[model samples]
Target chain A: MSLPELLRKISPTIWELPVTYKEGMRVPARIIASESLIGGMEAGVFDQAANVACLPGIIDYAWCMPDGHWGYGFPIGGVAAFDPDSGVISPGGIGFDINCGMRLCLTNLTEDEVRPRIRELVDQLFFAIPTGVGCTGFVRCSRSTFRRVIENGSRWCLENGYALPEDLEMTEEGGRFEGADADACSDKAVERGFDQIGTLGSGNHYCEIQVARPENIFDAATARAFGITIPNQVVIMFHCGSRGFGHQVATDYLQTFLKVMTTKYGIKLYDRELACAPFRSPEGQAYFAAMKCAANMGFANRQVILHRIREVFSRLFHRSPRDLGMDMVYDVAHNTAKLEKHIVHGVERELLVHRKGATRAFGPGMTGLPDRYRDSGQPVIIGGSMETGSYLLAGEASAAPTFYTTAHGSGRTLSRHQAKKMVQGRKLLDDMERRGIHVRTDSYGGLAEEAGLAYKDIDVVTRVTEDAGLSRRVAKLVPMGNIKG
Target chain B: MPYRFQDEITTADVAFEAWGDTREELFISCATALLRTMTAAPEQVAHEQKRVIRLKHEELDLLLFSFLQELIFHKDAHRLLLHADSVRIEQRESIFKLVATVSGEPIDAARHRLLVDVKAVTLHRFQVLFRDNQWRAVVELDV
Candidate 1:
């Protein structure tokens, strides 16, 4: 069967269209979705994915995660790998929010044990960890220290007493993109990132407590391997990135690359946002280096936030983070660019893989994994809106076809404005409260902007991801308390 | 629409957005909204200059993106408050082209207060469409 034909009844959750569906496409298109969720992909999302296939050296299929939605040049929740020799790195693939990813930290306490202290904890967190749109945090690093952050990522946090040595082992890419070039970053990107460390930049970035009830564990063996503790143990998970610092680096490089895409590399793009230079071109090399800086900043950002959370927990529970049994579970960046090896046409090929709005789901025993999780696949933290449930998943065998990637979140279904207009802030707050969800926000608008109704049904989305053989589920998590920046 | 500068976000409004009949107008409105959010109207004139820039978009979505970044370029380049005086969209066989003329004046503190630097335009929640017999562009920024 052809791609689109195979899509016809591939479990109400899958959709595929072959190269013949779109002229000039080098690879076919596959969409992991269910019927109800198909509307989310209605707005030129498939068209964007087809464009991705048309690129010079795309491999396998331009796969769209279940939460896929229309984005700049590539659909959000999109993943594609390009062969290094013939492939290109489109800024659109990694997104402007570099390393905007998730980190899950396990705690010893359960929902019943911490229910009473939730409010104070969130308040303390707000004070200790800066939030809001332009929020800055406690860390006041000098330029040299900022450079260290750019160079070392979470490692800098460990040296500065902000993270434990074990934390680095648990982070994807070991908390640092291995090939990052610190010197390639500009002074401005560094300046913007300095005070922003440990801060939770606003709009969809949040800190939440997920209740991992006994019944929610999907993979018992995998659950046991991750130190998730008992059935009722509570875990804290949050999503953020390098903040404006990362944004600046991506913006600066994107503009520079757009200016030279044709003149320097003879590369013509279907979209300017997809503007790219060759991987080794001066512009491309600079972007890759600068991109590493942003990725490191994100690692440091999450690491610092973890430290602040530790302080908050110690104060409320009268136990140190270690005593509370709080330890890093994993930190994985969904938006990133990395050079990894995968088999193409039955031959091992090095490819530049860009995963935007997607997470790396490297399977068990990848050498990069910490010893603690080597027997189990890397922990893939898939966060959903506060009202919905999230999942702890592991990469599956099928991931090898597309670089072990999966969807990021319950991708947006409503624009922020539409959400605010549709779900009034006061009502949304009341509804959440009525449902036993405790919510805090830097601005009520922020709350409204993230109204759970704005996103697709995460349950259905993740099921599709699993059904499609992208990532396998381990546990489901429901939020008890949330701090939205 | 006259620009309504939003700085102090009320519990009721998390962020602001703009709409227009043309992609250019929608982008200009968004640019004005972004500038208004960044700082108050120039109460004290800091400086002034004019910037001419170009934007090309293969999709209606990127056209809006290029237009917003053009405004960012002006804000960073001239250190002045800008208002798009005019905009024109020309479509080639494969791309939608934009030529805009904008004016900027020095920052007048009495009128301006920095709100948020729209770090960059995201492909997230970006849209350009024809609806209800009109062209409308919808976009959200990473503030």
Candidate 2:
């Protein structure tokens, strides 16, 4: 049957593919998208979602978020939970850039205050923060220091005088995951990561300056609770990952799993990229350990970037960072696997949840959230195209069907080459200028590749996530300026 | 007339196909394509300094993968835009060895316009094949 024919509309916002649709599938697959969104969906989305269903120990259904698109193994917006005892862990499910995530920084400055200095601010930010391909950061570390950053994560940042205490509070997992061994990483991984820390690399990674649109605030109480009370409140949002360190870790594991998956674990996969090992096996444990190191490094990476941003604000505004109130609102990882206890069918089960290109949208009262945000649920920051706008959302209890996950962004609708073919870089710059958005980029061609038209509408994507009850909107944020790598 | 690289559209990432009459030339062509992706004009990379890269893998596919990553590492580590002027690949038993002499100058903002940073070479759909007295390889880069 065709992909659309195999899907059964379970609700106005959800669709399902029964296990009967494909052989070897243990559970049915579910997709959270509106009819129109599903209509434009690529066949790869359904194929990958169904393939995930075939993996052993997968509980509930393989999930494809509204921002779904074809990825290496799992769909870019795929989410699945595995039974620790019987399930497996796949690096592809986590992604090449492990722990690639979004961080939102709340500031006291209003849009009006930033608007006048937007261009200069962006220029300052672009130069102050190392960006673009093949760039390094201000923090030059020895090999030992690199290992510590990998092992200790944000704690290393604090010790190095790059992070404040509160920065760790709002970070996911306190910016550290236990069991990370520096030895788990290869020498090559260390070499690649040695100088790239805190630098924003290329392709889709960015630091954007955004303003809260009062007119689009959906949940005022929640927004106010999150300290985004004023209309035109300016904030900074940036997306990046663990850099070359994570890539090497993933490469090292993918190779190991390919050899051991069939020989020792007796597991088989349809795609080689879906390389995996049982969660409890030695190989799996090692990868987990190394993955934690990468995750920690990712946190530290962002923490360092945060330090640079604060410094820029301090210098530009002629005030201390404390006076600027550049506090971290929250950080969320779109790509990761964590062991969480969730009640499945009235029984508490420790499931290994793998969220690739999906955000953790734990509902209110979930453990691990900061005290200030415990009552508001986990904050979900969905980065939209530079031209349209982005959003802040809160997880809903009603989203347990897919293990409390939501869309990461308005996922790509056009290929980079296709985007470049369709949009001219200079024209895009002119257009963004017309929209009153300041852009500072190393490559104008890179800017064209991320034009708003290249992506699905953010409003529609967020509405589907909200309509489906995965996450509810808190406030809409439009960019006033951006720095792209 | 020996070897060239052609870009392919996959999804969000970048992919390319490189071909040559010999495996050594194929490797050089692939690395050139990679350098070109990072900048618009690879020819403008002056041979101000040179670096040697050596890699060994049991399989040719992996050897190429590591070899390209090695070049990218130099570019990122030292901020150099390198071009592989000479490449030699040899197989002994099951393992393959590659030695390349690459030369380029430090990135000059006035002369070179930077593009996407090729983060890592992916194994997704990665292959190296020989057909019709010609060698071809397909690599997808995580940009």
Candidate 3:
């Protein structure tokens, strides 16, 4: 049967596949998307989400967000909360790049002030921030220091003059995950990631200069609260994670889990990528600690990248980052499995919420949000393709349906190969320039692969999230300049 | 000629199918495909450095997975863009062991038109099959 035929519509935006839809399902699988979005989804997405429902101790519903697409094991935008005692922790639920996320920094400069110099800004950024495959970072540190950096995350950046105190407050988990032990990480993982702190790795990762036009501000009061008050304000937003370090961590644990998941734990999986161990087992605890280390490394990687952005802007604009009002609005990780307290069936329980390619949209008054955002809710940054615009959103109280999680980005609609066949990289560069968006990339082939047409409509994604009551749109950000790796 | 990219199999990452007359040739074909994913032109990577790798696994497919992961490790840890020069796989009882010689140089951005980084090989639909008297494997990379 077709996915649409098997799924029962719960609402205009919510669709559910009953547990009977597939064997071994622990609970129903839900997809939160508009009809149009749901209709366009590939069968692999539904199959993957259903596969997730079959995992041990998955509570409530297995969810696929508006940006859902087929991933290796769990669908991109997959979310599920697993019980600590009865559940399992799978690397596939967290992704290869631990804490791979979005960071938005607000600036006082207007498009008029930055547009004329867009080429220079992009060029300087491309130079200052090492990008592409096998790129090393600018931060020089010993292995011992690197251990501390991974353990302490953005806190190390603060002490080393790369981050301000306020930046930590604005970052998720105050820029560090507790219980991160460097000992839990493999030396191979450490070696692979230690030198990648300030570098942006290749493939769909970017740093963009975007403008918030007066017309695109959807909620002016909330936007003002998030420090996006200026009309035509140019903000710097970047997407990356812990580079090679996180990849190695996930890779190591994946193999370890695969070896023991069935023989040692008797856990059966629909896919090998979904291999997992009992959450309370020795293997699982060690992986949790190691994953936390990678998460911290991701935080530090972006922190250092933020420092470079500050340095370049200060040098070019002849003003300190602080003087230019270049304060971070927020940094959020989409790929993570974090423990949080949530009310399930009228009982408050601590559950490990795994949000892969999904954002935590904690509503107003929810715990973990900073006091400054206590009333307005957490800021949710949904990055779009370079040609299309991105959105700034706020969590809504109405997100209780999906554990306060929402879509990450305008998810891909085409494969990279398919995208490359549609547009030439040189032509894309020239076209973007002609359209007033300056771009600098490490490889044109890579650039062509990320052509905007490769992704779903960002506007539609934002509308679906809002309509589904997962998040509310605050402002739309149009790119002025971009640096792609 | 031994490998081709399977564009339709994955959306966010890259996938390919490789075949060989023997398991050794299959490993080399898979290595070549992995190298091509990271660089538009893998032949441009000079064989200035050489590394020998030996690994054993109880399963044939996992042996292939470990072999590819070793290449990714060198790329991440040492920034080397390597390709397998020769591979030999032997089975003893239920265990499969692989020994290979790989060669490449540290990636020079000026010399190589690098593509996206292949983060890790995925076990999703990962396979090593002996079909039609030829050894074949299907692999997907998390980019």
Best by lDDT: 3
lDDT of 2 by residue, B40-80 (tens): 76778899999888888898988888888787767766788
On a 0 to 1 TM-score scale, where does candidate 3 land against the true structure?
0.99
> Considering DockQ, where higher is better, how would the candidates rank from best to worst?
3, 2, 1
Model 1 chain B: lowest-lDDT 10 consecutive positions: B5-14
- Determine which window of 10 residues in candidate 3 chain A has minimal summed lDDT: A1-10
Alpha-carbon lDDT, every model: 0.76, 0.87, 0.93
Report how large a share of the reference interface contacts model 3 reproduces. Answer: 0.80
Quote the positional error of residue A433 for candidate 2 in Å.
1.5
lDDT string for model 3 (A39-71, tens) is 889888988999999999899999999999988
Which candidate gets the maximum TM-score versus the true structure? Answer: 3
What tens-digit string does per-residue lDDT give for candidate 1 at A127-200?
A: 77776645567887887878888888998888889989889988988898776777887776666567778888
How high is the DockQ of candidate 1? 0.14
TM score of chain A per candidate: 0.96, 0.98, 0.99
Question: i-RMS values of the candidates, in order?
Answer: 7.7, 1.9, 0.7
RMSD of each: 6.4, 2.1, 0.9
Best-to-worst order by lDDT is: 3, 2, 1
C-alpha positional error of residue B68 in candidate 3 after TM-score superposition, expressed in Å? 0.6
